[model samples]
Target: MNESTRQSSEPETKRQGLSGNALGAIFMLLSGLGFTVYIVLSKTLTEDVHPVFLAFWRSFIACLISVPVIMRAGIGKLKTRHPGLLLLRSLFGTLGFTLAIVAISADFDLTFSQFNAISFSRSLFVTVLAAIVLRETVGIHRWGAVGVGFLGVLIMVVPGVFIFWAASGGDGFSLDLGTMTAIASAFFLAFAIVLVKSLSAELSAVALLTYANVLSSVLLLPFAIYYWSTPDLETWGWIIVMAGVGFVAQYCYISAVSVGDASFISPLDYLRLPMATVADLIIVGMLPGMNVWIGAAIIIVSAAYITFRDRNKKAQKVKVLTDR
Candidate 1:
């Protein structure tokens, strides 16, 4: 190819890449908003329905939502050589999703924003888990970021502990089950992320999701059935809405990652924090406490730093390799 031709083509290629990234950012934003609704709807429903039953419906509805995708991909696409790891992923993913519902079911007196803030702790957990479980070499910057992130978590959590104590007239400091379950949700989610990193090479994303929904539905079925109460049509509508939004959010997230670099798309997920706060104010008439704002800022900054730094490092490595 002539030099002038190649130079002209480069700009076009760059424009296409930029356009793709923009599309991805939009998808990720919609995903964040969808997830925000999912949280609010789930919280609203906790009044009459058991979380276990809610989780079961979530899985079942998600599976129903996936039917078209699964059919389009065909049965062959669902086959995976890594069944054990997929099972492990299903186990942790199920725990993470169900525990999140369980956490919200508890009367923590927290707004949806405050409750959802704990979910961001998953990134910190993923960093540590990558080092321990995957034996991935994490640099000093990442480690430092993880430390600061945990400090932010403490900032959010310790204040709540104090508030609870004062409210209970000095009933000695103890973290409530709701809070612990939220943290556990983050932990399980992190583990599932690590497992995904391992299994991504051997399995298609569709296959992984297909198994996750199907297996979680089966796992939660007994508990869901035991606690089942027939929801009125209105409540059923809300449940379907919750599950539909969640499915859309999941689809958008996957589409975003497929189109753009994960690092580039990840910062968009933080939009859920503010979205949740807005949903809280509008739906529940609640404002987040100062601790949530302060700690969430710290966590978001630390996570963004980690993502950007890692992206730069990867870019430099690619450049060096290309030059050679």
Candidate 2:
């Protein structure tokens, strides 16, 4: 085998009866579980608590949890040269986070799996946003992938609505409002992803996260405090758990990528759909519609293809440079 082929295979080598890919898959699965659980916890609280307040407290608790870790990086890491990009990313991240909670709120009346399915579209959104914001070259293949992926999103979101909307007298369209909001949440998050790419050149991940938490808390403090009510003991327990687990989920994702190639580990994240489905079934006796499964599968495949292709393209570029 060539050096490149051997290099690629190294991550797959087993040690202690487990390979890096296996460990990465495990971590990604755990991260997905943590994230899904956090969403479920937030959904539970949204009935009794306002979404805005929930969003703010999530940031607040995350801020508290991150204190020691950020402190270890010292106050200096908190300072960044790219203040404008940082601020923009933070705002976008906060809005995305808040919108996600609102989508899962009682106002939406969506099933747990349905709400989580919206996130499948995020990678599609990121592709479009990258082209627009980053001026990246997107080949026709990727464009086709994006188009097909969004068809899947529509399938999951509106399903029969498009076919029957005129016959249903528009009621079907209105009923899809919740799903649309979830897609919008994904849009904002994809925008944040593009911004993070730009800022990563100058910022540590910890610094970026700290800024997001602090800024989100500050920006959201007024609204949260305005709607705040004293939570009962049980609610407090959920709040702490949600915050702590959510933060850990972020670390789990980071560590997963650090341990294995992004292409190998990213596919494992699709496990979240089944994980969320099972969670919904057990916790709320809810099951995702067939449309959601079909759509999610399409989105997952398209997103994985995009990631894999991008990794190969980057590797080829490196190979070309090395040959020179």
Candidate 3:
């Protein structure tokens, strides 16, 4: 290729790259909106159906949706060298899904915004788990971010604990089941992520997703059957919509990451916090307390910093390898 032609092609390539990133940003925003809708629907339907049952249906629907993808990718692609780890990952993921639903349900006192805000702690958990489990070097910078993130979590939860204590005339301090479950869900989700990181070396993304959804459906089946209550037609309609929206959200997130750097798109996910807060006010007629706003801001900034730091580390590693 001639120099003038190469220069012209370089400009076109840059334009195409920018367009892809723009599209990725749009997809990330849509994914956030879709997940917010799914969460709001879950909160609404949990009034009439058990959370375990809802989780099973969601997983089963996702599995059904994966059938086409698996068929196209070839069933052999679903095979993995490490079945035990995959199963464990699915179990943690299912637990996370069920607990998250319970946390946001009417049975729990937590508002949608609080649930969303607390969920951001998953990144903090991931950093800690990566250091301990994966033995990845976590610098003091990330450790400090993790600390700040936990402080944010405490900021959000302690206010409610004190409120409960005051209501009890200072007899005791307690965290509500909803808050506890939300935090637990984040830990389990982060564990699942760590497991996925281990498994990704041997399994394709399609296989990983398929295994998780199919295994989650199987794992939750008995519990779902035990807790099942027949939903009215309207409730069933919403359930179906929720599953479809959740699947689309997952697709949008994958699409965003495929087209752009994950670190660039990840912070857009925090959009769900405000989206959920608005959704709660409009749908559930509730607003997040001031603590939620302040705490969520802190957690998001910390998590974003951690994400970028990880990205930079990976880039440096790649650069070093290329320079070699």
Candidate 4:
């Protein structure tokens, strides 16, 4: 192309990139709002419904929701060469989903902000798992960020546990089930993410999501039945709404990643912490402790730095290859 033509096209290309990034940011914000709604609804319903049962219905509904996509894509499109790996991925995902629900259930007594803050640790867990399982190289910078991230988690969790111990007159020390389950959920979710990264080369997104939801339904069916309590009509309405909102949120997240630079879009996801905090204050009339706010800020900074570093490394590698 001639100099004038290329110069004109450069401006247009920059504009388009900015536009796509703006759209992705909007989608990320909407996703954060949708998830906040879903979590609030789950907390409300868990007043009467069992979390296990709620989890089963969520998976079942999500599976049903995927029907139209599958039909449009053709059944053969769902076939995978790595069924065993897919199953393992689904198992970890199901465990993560169920435990997350349980962590926020009424019986668990965890505030929404606390749950959201802890959930951010999934990225840290992913870094660790990638190093160990994927044998990915971990530079000192990323390792330091991970260390800071765990320190943030400790800041959020340890203080509360100590206060509770003091309240109990220091008779015995025990961590709350809610905190344990929240951490477990993040770990399992990270493992599932690592597996998905491995499988993405061989499977389409539709296949991965469809298989995960379907298998989650199957795996949780027996437990759901054993713990089942029939929901009233009102509860049923909320359950359906929760499923729909969750699906849309998941779609928005996927879209955001696909359409724009992931590093640019990812920090927007931290909006969920504030979104949840506001929703909790308005709906449940509760605020997370000061530690939650402080710790979550630290975790967000750490995670964003990790993402920035990873993006820079990838860009450098691409530049090296192109130079060669």
Predicted model with the maximum lDDT: 4
Q: Candidates ranked by lDDT, best first?
A: 4, 3, 1, 2
- Single out the weakest 10-residue window by summed lDDT for candidate 2: 165-174
lDDT of 3 by residue, 39-61 (tens): 88888899889988999998899
Q: TM-score for each prediction?
A: 0.90, 0.89, 0.91, 0.92
- Model 3 poorest ten-residue lDDT run: 165-174
Q: Each model's C-alpha lDDT?
A: 0.84, 0.84, 0.87, 0.89
Instruction: Give all candidate RMSDs, comma-separated.
Output: 3.3, 4.0, 3.1, 3.1
Tens-place lDDT digits, model 1, residues 14-125: 8775576788998999899898888778877888789889999999999987867888988888767788888888999999999998887745555678667889989889
Candidate 4 per-residue lDDT, tens place, 62-94, comes to 889986788799989777888899999999999
Error of 4 at 295 (Å): 0.9
Number of the top TM-score candidate: 4
- Model 1 residue 170 lDDT score: 30
Give the alpha carbon lDDT tens digit for every residue of 3-63 in model 2.
9999877765643466678778888988999999988888888888898998998899999
Clashing pairs in 3: none
Off by over 4 Å in 1: 1-18, 160-174
Clashes found in each candidate (C-alpha, N, C closer than 3 A): 0, 0, 0, 0
Number of the candidate with higher TM-score, 1 or 4: 4
Candidate 3: count of backbone clashes, pairs at least 3 residues apart or interchain: 0
Off by over 4 Å in 2: 1-19, 159-175
